[model samples]
Target: MNHKAWSIHFIYAGVILLLAGGQMYAVESYQLTPSATKFLAHNVGPGPETAQGAINHFMVNSNTGVRETITPPGWVAWAALSAGAVLSVHGGMLIANKR
Candidate 1:
């Protein structure tokens, strides 16, 4: 492949790796309290129940045993998606410029 194509490919790969890392971090760092789970179960749809359960389970594992704060996976996912999109655009520009 040409240098431009290679550069674009590298950019895309980097973005994918970043997104994957963020997803892994979010999955490992996820935490939710019992009260938060209860609230989500009552307020949010069933779809979020599993995530809430995971958080609740994590909370139970901690010594504090108190609901502190939680970072939703959606945020991480969105950020990754955004970064990927930006990378794709940058790659596209590089390819276009080479023509």
Candidate 2:
């Protein structure tokens, strides 16, 4: 492969590696403290009672507290945007170099 092709490949690989590393670091550092989830449960309101009910249910039934995993709709949209950007860059490079 040519220098330009190698450069693009390296750049893409570097970005993917960086993202993966950051994600792994985040997961390793993440702590699920009760207060944070409690605050989310309170403000986002499936209602305080419902939130507490979930906590109680988990504690009683599973011997562990509830984990409220909230992913907003915009997250998926942003992921799609990122994927589009990568694909567009790849396509543009490929098409521009076609002989």
Candidate 3:
């Protein structure tokens, strides 16, 4: 793909990562609303393996709007935030060069 397209992708992905990192840092535990009917079934324990991304999380759904509760490590959250900022700035620079 072109550099412009990659830049745009980077910007979008960075923004999403920044948002996720901010949420992870802001709250100790947050609810993840599920759109799938399968998630409405049972609660998931924090075992070695559960779901793909939910491996390290504890997910419990008891007829509530909440789906998963994630408690990310401090370093992971900071790293994500830093990476997001870097990617976003890099994408902006790429776009500037394209002009």
Best by TM-score: 3
Mark the regions of model 2 whose C-alpha exceeds 4 Å error after superposition: 29-99
How far does residue 70 in candidate 1 sit from its true spot (Å)? 11
For each candidate in the order shown, give its overall lDDT on alpha carbons. Answer: 0.64, 0.55, 0.70
Task: Determine the C-alpha RMSD for candidate 3 after optimal superposition of all C-alphas.
Answer: 6.6
lDDT of 3 by residue, 1-99 (tens): 999999999999899889988887887865556644225334343343557425333333334444544567788778889999999999999999999
Estimate the overall C-alpha local distance difference test score of candidate 2.
0.55
Q: Write the per-residue lDDT of candidate 1 for residues 1-99, one digit (tens) a residue.
A: 776967679587757867775675557455677667556545555343588666655554554546545555556666666677677777777777888
TM-score attained by model 2: 0.29
In model 1, the runs with Cα more than 4 Å from the true position are: 1-6, 14-72
Better of 2 and 3 by lDDT: 3
Q: What is the C-alpha RMSD of each candidate to the true structure, in Å?
A: 10.3, 10.0, 6.6
